[model samples]
Target: MTTPILLFLDINGVIDVEDTDVQGENLPQEYSTVYPVPGTKEFLQVIDSCSWIHPVWISTWGKQSQAWNKWAKTRCWPWAYPLDSDERHQALDLIGHGSDKYLAARWYSRDWQHRIVWIEDGFWLSSLYDSSMGAAVKWAENNSNVKLIDTAPTVK
Candidate 1:
């Protein structure tokens, strides 16, 4: 059986700008609205070339799946489907905490322990606390099978 590959994506900072930055003479305006960050589309294309890649959006706005769909369509970020029922419940459980990224990781594909990759900007490498969940995050952080792209835009 082929291992299922899960790609966890973040919205705000990873795919879009979190805030503005002051440059020498030109102030960089923040891209507050949702859109794929630089090189994101190319990255998605590369993953898509792989037959096992399964993309999943892991963001605080996951509750607003519709909004995310619209944004994805606009930016053309590859996606398979909105969060599944189990993932939705998991996200609901993490409501206000900035730990939604960690919560989403817990809701990865059923066989994700074998093959999974989380790509996001908000996830803290050392902040995961839940034993089972923490192990999973650490596995991704340490293993070559997984990757985390901190897409926080650079001020120019």
Candidate 2:
């Protein structure tokens, strides 16, 4: 049997994004509006059809399991599994308080960085928490699989 692909997924800047005229950005970053990024439904349709792609919710937006699952179901977003607050907090402790999303995925994927496919926005962003963090993200980007989704121009 082939090894199934591990997909670590994020909510904001991905399926959800800064709403344009139709909607407004979530100031609190709660993403309550539920404006899906352009082509998100189509992308998820393809992803869900692929038996190999195993997507796991790795962002704080969906840290709450029930809400996240509900959101996924409402939008028909492949119904990815969500990491609860406890699991997310434990992973955060490993890398300290910061926005290094790849690190969080690392814990969830069980250090299977190279094999896992991470879909988030941080890798494409230029800012870095520290030299070490920058290096780590760089290393993961280079080694692990990543799809840097740019939701700059939201599709109306």
Candidate 3:
């Protein structure tokens, strides 16, 4: 049997960018649109076809859909689902942020025996997963599971 790998998914820098959309009364009009990075469809296809990769959405949508609901209405992704609220909450309680992309995957993964890889873009890159400080260099030096993949720019 193939081992299941947990994929922590991020929406913003990974697959989306901001656009002007009404949030609600007295709120800012900013929302995310489908800004699929290069090879996005193929990447998701691999996840769908591969039995070992399990995708868990770790976006700002983890707590509330926010603009994701709108985006989802327009974008179809049958291959992915977010970590449930309880799991997301637990990860947040542990790491103190719902967007703790790296830590959340480690703390709430359904299977630890399987490998975990995160496809994300955020402050973590410079902070080493520090939501509040900068220690990324030191953290990367110490962590064994982190892997970086290079990708092409989105087509305009």
Candidate 4:
């Protein structure tokens, strides 16, 4: 059997060109018109075909993740579970603004035995200032089970 792989996905620059930094905090309410990155369809297709890879949402959507879900539905993409718990989800500003995604994924997978694939645009956002961010980057680099894939704001 294939090993279970947790895919921690960030939507902003990973799946779409709408980087939170560029698009502002106010995301579009309607997703019907928004398009995804050029190769996103194929990428999603590979994830869909692989039963071992579990995709989880780790984007800036935070408490408003429902909006992301609505967007995913519009694109007919696979459902992505949130990495944040119900309590954390209630908190609006993520955990540490820039380092939230990386930190959350690290904390969430602490006890898990599954392999992890973290895809984020701002994975190293505060690495220089945040020790935890720097540590997380080091950990991902050294750990074979953890793979960090950085995406550009444009996704291509």
**Top TM-score prediction, candidate number:** 4
Which regions in candidate 4 have their CA more than 4 angstroms from the true location?
A: 18-29, 63-98, 129-132, 153-156
The residue ranges of model 2 lying beyond 4 angstroms of the native Cα positions read: 1-3, 21-31, 65-100, 111-114, 124-136, 141-156
Q: Please give the RMSD to the true structure for each candidate, in Å.
A: 7.7, 6.2, 7.9, 6.7
Ranking by TM-score: 4, 2, 3, 1
Per-model TM-score on C-alpha atoms: 0.50, 0.59, 0.53, 0.63
Give lDDT tens digits, candidate 3, residues 1-156.
Answer: 976766666666675543345222211236423454455456656665666776666665654433443333323322223556686676667655433444455565534555666665544343544544233223334655544331224334
Tens-digit lDDT track for model 4 on 1-156?
999998887776677675334432333574343346665657766775778877766766554544654433433333233444663453324344324455577656656697999887755664656765676578788888998887743323
Off by over 4 Å in 3: 17-32, 63-99, 123-125, 128-143, 146-156
TM-score, predicted candidate 4 vs. hidden true structure: 0.63
Model 3 clashing residue pairs (backbone): 128-136
Q: Rate the local accuracy (lDDT) of all candidates.
A: 0.51, 0.55, 0.49, 0.61
**What lDDT score is found at residue 8 in candidate 1?**
71
Using lDDT as the measure, what is the rank order of every candidate, best first?
4, 2, 1, 3
Which lDDT tens digits does candidate 1 get at residues 58-138?
665544533444433333334323456776576557432333345446545444565566665534433344453354446
Clash pairs detected, candidate 2: none
